[model samples]
Target: MQAVFATTQISERAAAFLPVERTDGFEERRYLDQRQSEYLRMLAELDELLLRNAVQWYQQQGRNADQWLSAVAAARQESRVQSGQGSATRRKSSDVFSRARKLMGERGFPEDQYPPKLVGFTPQQFGLERVARKGLERLKWELERYEPFALSVYSGATREFRTVNAPVRLPVDPLSPGEVEETCILTGGDPFAAGERVRPGVLSAVAGGAVVQLPETVSGRRLALARWIAGADNPLTARSIVNRVWGWHFGRSIAANPNNFGSTGGRPLHPELLDWLAAEFVDSGWSVKSLHRLIMSSRAYRRSSRPADAADVARLDPELRCLSCFPARRLTAEELRDAMLSVSGELNLQVGGIPNRPELHAEVALQPRQVMGSFAAAWVPNPLPAQRHRRSLYALRLRGLPDPGLEVFNLPTPDFSCERRDSSTVTPQVFVQFNSQNSWSRSLAMASRVLRETATEDGAIQQCFRLAFGRSASATELRQCLQHWRDLEAVQREAVFRTPVPPPEVVRDAVEENTGERFQFTEKLYGMDHFVPDLRAEDCDARTRALADVCLVLLNSNEFIYVH
Candidate 1:
């Protein structure tokens, strides 16, 4: 029976012993004998050198714990002294140590259980030693009890403060007649009555005669207003968005006036399509890209600009509102300039940084305007051509001085949102495209590109057509272009060779607003000092010059300016 028990002794039952549970005398004696025998066997199996090394390691751990505790205590004392809280801080520190020691003693780790070498250690170190000796259960219990207070103390110690100037508050008294006039001038508002003051509320007409309550605070009122405008129940927001996008693609919205959608505005020609699109836009979680894809991929959008049947042009779509075909529209000013630069290989497509300064006409660039007391600095293009050739989207937008080329092409003033661009066929546009120095330079560059990419005159003409319009020229167009190129070459051969004159020095004249006295200042042309001028007629051969004239004609063609 003893042999049978010995085999089963070290099995699962041996791992389930409870030290506090009392056992029968015979069982208890057997357990003690078994444990002693097992320990002896384990010691015999272990290497003597390994056993000695383990003992040395445990001794070194105790020494390390002692040193770490000593360092922590010294650091605490030094912090207290440096912070100028001498004796009071010392007394509080002592109280902390005393409380910690008492807590350790109560938690089954009495002072006598600790090593003799750790007797003089700080309470912080003593607590750590107790946790290490008693294991994770005791450490967890200690942390749960004290961690909140420790966190609060740490937060209080690291709190920061800064000095800030107080804001000036306006008086709450009613405005005087003079003050009301001044307020109207400053805010661009109608003159209020003697006791009138602005307050937050919905318009009475929109509120439907119901009592509407609003928050007293300004920010709360703004948030409430924003919620009202962006709420899911608002159909106008979604409908207006769809109409604007439609207008952008077709040059006219389903509703004629994109900004005005009320009873006063022109009624939508296709009300069902507009309502369905708005509903779908809202149902798709207000996704703009999904809405765009839905509209752009439709059959109506893909239809050819030309009518399928000439008879249907008058009967089926008299007003061109039946979606019979796509509408051909002139490119906007920004699009026109960007396209020209792109075809000439002068476009810089780098995205998103500070706005660039494209080379403006010298007259506009050097014009002086009164600012404060003195005249403002001259407008200079960015030094590098890469910057000067950036897309029109990156061009610096000045409200006072718009780009001359863009202005001539009917670019709206920047004072308000342009719901739709006007595409008027003006004579100035022709001059800007054909006569401007910038246009001449771009033409030269385009001609150079054609020469570099093509082997023969016929190939160059075809290449020019492909670059300008997205397709090759027809047989008649090809023949006419070659003839024009030959004629220009003969004319350029006999042209007088004159030295290219530089732009004249600019003298800025501004009248002082305060004194009404005129002042003249020489505007510095810093960008011109390192300017890399584009290819010109003088720099190229007669053939190249003639090719530029052909390119200039292509650039000014109706096909290049309009998008079908």
Candidate 2:
């Protein structure tokens, strides 16, 4: 019979109690703290009693309860006598297991099946361990009548206010384990309680332009905010979205500033047109496609940038505020990059996938970038040409590590919302277009594409113009380009061009944290070993190289970069 019941349940539970295979270091107090000592003590008594009267206890079923109680009383008295205490007390948890060993020998069970000897396990820890195990049923029953656990209230923050007269502030105890709730003060620096709660209401310039009180619910804050944002009374959302789409096509938004609409922001240039668009936008069930269709089909939108008496119109309307003609503006950084790739016949139109790693300037890609003390891995362009030439929208943008080609062209950082891009022609833009490897590579590919599509040199020159400027070359322009190509071909046949030399790994110097000394480390450039580089000057014949030179000139031309 076991201590808790007239079965082997106590022995079985105790056998599975210790987390370890054996209580080897219990004598050194190592595992004794971790084991459930009370479980062991209970098993000790069960084993001792079973060895002496297993047959007698089962045969006398009527007297089993009385006999078990008597045995418990006897064990307690023996524990008290052994401890030299004046009153009866629970037996030492560690010694109880020792007492079980003597009895197990008489039971004829193998030594391996004996209870774990928790030598240094204290009775106090056993009390906690017991409450955590099966004996927890008893504690839970008592707790159900009252309360067991409750969340703690109150928190503290450092008195960092600089208005204090004293030179040094008093040292305050820091927050301990799991106590990190911070209370923001409303009227005073009270840390014990939370701030004064504000009435849940929405502030907006719609529906009489005042704060509207929200209906209260069990959980109302987020739900109230959602309703207010989507409410029919709020037309700000409709106007703002319409202005952004309008700005994307027109280069300048109706409101001038898409992000700001307050008194500080410029008033809409064409208020009536903006209002009509907004009204139609809301009426069409907020469909973006409907707005695009309406705007693109307008006569004003279809107007040519070069209207009749262009010089007279330029003098009459210097700002082009009359909206008599379409505006001619440079393509955006993204649009420019995509246009070049499209011209080269390498644009990949695949949508929605992993962020692409387009080829960057060598200085930027091979440099060691530090991230929280360790060096970041080398930047590797995608191995496949299709993946490498994905649309600029899918390219990965790292903060403070701008891709030189796009950055030079005034591509805004993704760190914050850019209501409008600032387009300025800088010296770097010229270098990126004329001197950068990416530009040269695109030109070479474009040349290859033109030659592959056209039958003769004259036809290839015409194809280049169509792809680059979206128009056929004039007769005079075609003749000049053909002469330039012929002359370059003669020079290129004598010119020496070398193949690209991509390094397998780049070695960089880094500072060692422990020694405070610089050391060199190697970073493997992923996919560089198997990189499929774009067409280069050395990849084709002298005629193709000369045509690539012509393509480079076209790519750098203002006509190719600007959209009319």
Candidate 3:
């Protein structure tokens, strides 16, 4: 079978564009004694050729004769060091010193004695860089031509050379929008047809083989690829994605680097099990749901997130080589917000549709956004409950606009398909939770729900624990929470209960354009005239107030925010 190479492999040739300085500053005796000396000789010759070319360029431009003589002296000294076979300190300052003296001794008076210099003699600036660039251009041309010929035969004949006919492919520079558009249009290739050959397979003349061009897009490509990759026949892709999923769940993939599966990537700890799961996932109709079920069903996933085995602490298992215990992980950006809304009885579970705008913070919502040429209209949430309440996944994702809260929680940008989400803890997350008005509103709604369900202060506290931790609170926790509720109740009696405020009826603003002009328009809210959820704190008695306290705590705890 003929071997194929990735684009990266071909691109690796560009590394040669960087010139290798032949001045190793060592005597040639070291390399000469060893069979490896021939390599060094060739390298020195290449470097000498580079320097000679530079000198010739300068001489061509009518430079002083001293410049050419100086270059020749320098070359002689370089040759001496490269060829001499003596101790570094003892041997020859003579050959180098003689050259230096000769360079210094030269004093010229006649214009005719001047050495030729390249048209512009600016003091050795950009000379080396220019040479390197020229060398690269020559190399590129040589490689293009060499592909057709330059073959040596075992029958002892001179290498044959043939003219090159390879197509010249210009790279797209991102700085030019026109170039980018052109590339996109050219690469897009017959999008009108469902099954059209977009790119032709490349056939190598020498190799007598071809590289196939696969379809770039397909209706069920992801599903089909998933099936093939996860199947027992394919070991690479299953291990790759599984490790990725593991990384998302535990903040560390079993293979360390999830995407890389070559010899360089860390070997799997439970290789057999990984293969088993990969095969199982494929056998189970490539069902994503089934895969999740198997993973979550494992004893590894269910073990207490807390460290229970103290003596086993010595066996830290730094690499987490075994299925010891469940790893605690921070909730994903979507999960964090979704779980909060779910707990607070405010999550909208409506499925797919054209993305509806959700309520954004006033500071963010009112901010000006730039579209193609002019400022785009400000974001306005759907006024109706069913519309605004849809899942975050299904929300109309703006490429230019990201929810500030979600951003703080490490939500991935929508520009590219994200393989996994990053969970990073930072101070911004703290401010997002405490300072954002959205969090406050959510807390209040949760508080009210708890107060309505559990009348007494103690009962409200227990309910808070139940809602947040999914279990009843201990006696001590209940006592502490009861005290907190009693204090809150006194405060609530003096201060009236608040109702959920209605969304804005209309937002009027001048839209700014990229050209710096503004246009005025009033964006109407569809259902703003309807009754809004009332935040009527006064309507509820002390009992309902207590449940609100429970709800508030439940919404605030780490238990509510993390997934183990």
Better of 1 and 2 by TM-score: 2
Per candidate, the number of residue pairs that clash is 0, 0, 27
Question: On a 0 to 100 scale, what is the lDDT of residue 249 in model 2?
Answer: 78
C-alpha RMSD by candidate, in order? 28.3, 21.5, 25.1
Compose the digit string of candidate 1's lDDT tens values, residues 261-375. 7678989999999999999999999899998899889998888888879687879787778778888889999899898898889898876544677878877877765332234
Candidate 2 vs candidate 3: which has greater lDDT?
Answer: 2
Cα error, residue 527 of model 3, in Å, equals 5.5
Candidate 3 structure quality by residue, lDDT tens digits, 79-100? 5775577542222222332343
Model 2 regions more than 4 Å off: 1-196, 209-224, 310-316
Residue 560 in candidate 2 has what lDDT? 86
Candidates sorted by TM-score, best first:
2, 1, 3
On lDDT, the leading prediction is 2
In order of lDDT, best first, we have: 2, 1, 3
TM-score of each: 0.62, 0.65, 0.55
lDDT of 2 by residue, 235-326 (tens): 67777788888888778888988988645787888888888898898889888999999989998788888878878887987677666788
lDDT of each candidate versus the true structure: 0.63, 0.65, 0.53
Model 2 lDDT at residue 513: 49
